[model samples]
Target: MDLEKRHEPPLRQTPEGCLAVAIRIPVRIVVLVLVVPVRMVWDALVVVGRFLRDTVFRPLGRALSWLARAVFVWPLVALWRYGVVPVGKALGWLGKVLLVIPLTWLYRQVLTPLGHALVSMLAWLYARVLTPVGRAVAWFLRGTGLVLAAIAGGVYAVVAWLARYLLVVPGRWVYEWILAPVGRLIAWCARGVLWVLEMLFDGIGTALYWIGRVLFVLPALALWRWVLVPVGRVLAVVGREVWDALGHAWRVAGRISLAVGRALATLFRWVFVEPVRWAYRTVLTPVGHVVRDVLVRPVAAVARSAGRAAREALAAARESVRQARADFRRMLLGEPRRVEALDRREPTGPETRTLGSSTTALTKD
Candidate 1:
């Protein structure tokens, strides 16, 4: 298995050189050194930004949003809800009363009758006045068309006789007897001349093609194959290796930056966070507890007690006032009669039913 694995083809990779190897270490080192401080500062800025967002900016945003709503949105909403909506409704009612009702009445009483009368008048005019004029015009155009058609037939006959004798007969005789022989002779001579020219041009083109091939095409091919291809290959390899090196260096720098960031974070946690947390826990927490227990709790308890007593006194006074009002009302109007409830929930009456005391026709006590 080991031999087979060793014999197996390796993965295909672009070749690298000593130059790439030489560049990699220095570039990564320089990038790491440059990135560490930036990463630390970035992390610090990120932390501060988060702290500000949570503590300051969030509350400010909420307050600003509330203020904006109170200042702008709420007033607009109130105007729309209270002013615009009521006015719109009133306008709609007025439109319905003033415009809609009046227009509807006018349309029904005035316009509809007027439209019917106009339609009748138009129908009468079209039937009585315009129809006969149109019929006469059509008849006149029909008679004129028939007369023009007869005149056109006579003109066409004269033109056809003149064309056949003077133009068609003479042209046919010239084409068949004289022009035909001359045209055939000219075509035959042109064919022979074209053939000779074609052969001559073919020979010239072949010679030129071979000359150009030897002069330009073969040399260009040789240059492209031998010179440009090798040079381009070398350039492509160098470019690819340089790009790969940059990517590898950037990744290495990112790792270094992460390590430095973590180290700084640990240092900050120990130096600043731990001490502050310790002070808050050891000193401030106990002080806060003492203040809350000694001053705040007692004051809160006293306030709560006073408030409860005040509420009780107010409730008692309200009850007394209510009773006095009731007594005075009773003195003026006497006591009101109380109605008895008629709805019952029980199946039997006050006493439980027994067989001996049954009130049915079958059994009675």
Candidate 2:
């Protein structure tokens, strides 16, 4: 049994030994069978991806980028640098040579000479024709004015003499002969009438005086002597008593009126003035403030907003009208459109009608 045991391997009995056996078998199978092929496939894919990125895709991207630069960027740069810039410079030179130089030359050489000639001609005309005519006309007008003034002065003097002889002299004669005598006669009659009236007034006054003396003065003296003395004594005593009573009553009435007036003034101050002041302070003033803040200020703001809106609307309308007018002027002056329809293959029948309508509209505008 010892010899057999030494020849045979040791047998395991625990779960740890069993677990090790199971893990070793699978690890060998996975490493040998599955992991080797998988590693190979992954390495191949990496090689292919690297080859594509480095060789194929890189070259393609570089070629595409070069083509884009040549086609788009290089052409634009060349056009701006060489074609557009040179063409613009050439056009500027041509404009200077054709338009500016010619216009300047015309202004300096032709127009200036023509203006000088015209001025010389006008000066000659003034010297030859207008000066003599103007001088003669001024002389004639001055002579005519002098003659007219002399004639007017003589006529005025004659008229003044004639008026003095005809109207003033005759008026004076009439006043002295007819009016003066009539005035004197009327004065004499007035004097006689006044003297007669004076005598009649004196007689009436004297008679009235004698009648008053007889009828009133003597009776008044007799009444005074006989009856007034006794009556005066009795009336004096009664008048004294009545005067004292009236003075007392007047004093009492005045004091009552003053007291009543003071009471009325105090009542009016409390009822009318104080209440009015309180209402103004508490109610009316606050109401005024509320109205200002809420109603009046808002209304003013609305009005301002409406005004601004109206102004903006008016400005927009004016801009639109100005643009329309500019377009109309361009049309009338045969200016080209901003963008041309270059894609059209041919003109159709509608183009003719549209052209005719456009011409008519331009004419109308």
Candidate 3:
């Protein structure tokens, strides 16, 4: 039974036996699992209580502190406001007056008179020169515009008169005197040239006849004597055969040449007419799109960019020129300026005499 019990399970101890028994279980671990956790919870509650006390009471303490500060410092605040703020404001005013003194002195000494003089000068210039210049410019522009308009109107009138005259009388006169006469003269000349060409052709025919007689007839006669005589005698025996052969050959060559000429003419017509017709339908019909996208659009863009750049450059140049003129005038009217130390001074009389002698010697040399 003891062996079975030992083998089966260890019996649990009672509370008194557990207290008396020595075991490996740790008391500190027991306390940590139960008593320590309860104590930690109690300490956490205490900490929470202290935290609440501090949090809930801090504002009151601060209020008391603020109340004490108010009771102590209210009079001090009033005193400081009366003493320091007014003194500070007075000092600020004094500082502003001190700051203004130099500015007032400068205004009285230089700026006021400069301003008045500048205003007076500007007013005088406006009255004396500017008004006249503006009036003159306005008049000049108006006159120029009038002149341009008159010129344009005159040109339009003259053009209209010329057009009317040309359409009515001068065109007819030109047709009669110049065009008709010239055409008649050209026709007459062409007829004369045709006659001359006919005469020349007749003369050339005569010359060719003579040349044939001189160059080919004798030679042909000689060839006939040498070769054709025997051949002719033979051909005389077969005259129909020879004539048939020659006629057949001539007919074939003529047909071939005619066929070639007709083919060439057809090819020329196809190349010049058919391709042009097709291109007119396929490519040339859309030529306005090409012009707008390729030629006209790019040209317009370039013109706009160039015009903008040119206008900007001209404006900048005009401003630069105006500023240059202003600077030149200011320099001319400005105070006498000190010369650069590096610049040579004018020679005294003795030095100039010596320099003249040296120059004369140099020239002589």
lDDT of every model, 2 decimals: 0.88, 0.81, 0.76
Name the regions of candidate 3 deviating beyond 4 angstroms: 1-87, 150-365
Return the candidate ranking by lDDT, descending.
1, 2, 3
Worst 10 residues of 3 by lDDT: 19-28
What digit string (tens of lDDT, one per residue) describes model 3 on residues 1-365?
A: 77666465778964533322222134333333444434444555776788887998887889998998888788799889899999999999998799878788998999988999999999999999999989999988997998899889989999999888768787788888889988988999999999999999999899999998999899998898999787876555355444444455445544555565578779988989889988988898799788899899999999999999999999999999999988998788975568777645555675554544553446643
Candidate 2 lDDT score at position 84: 96
Candidate 1 clash pair list: none
**Model 1, stretches more than 4 Å misplaced?**
1-72, 82-98, 121-152, 174-224, 285-365
Top model by lDDT, which number? 1
TM-score of each: 0.56, 0.25, 0.22
lDDT of 1 at 169: 96
Candidate that scores best on TM-score:
1
- How many clashes does each candidate structure show, in the order listed? 0, 0, 0
Give the alpha carbon lDDT tens digit for every residue of 201-320 in model 1. Answer: 999999999999999999999999999998997777667656665566566656776787789889999999999999999999999999999999999999999999999999999999
Model 1 steric clash total: 0
lDDT (Cα) of model 2: 0.81
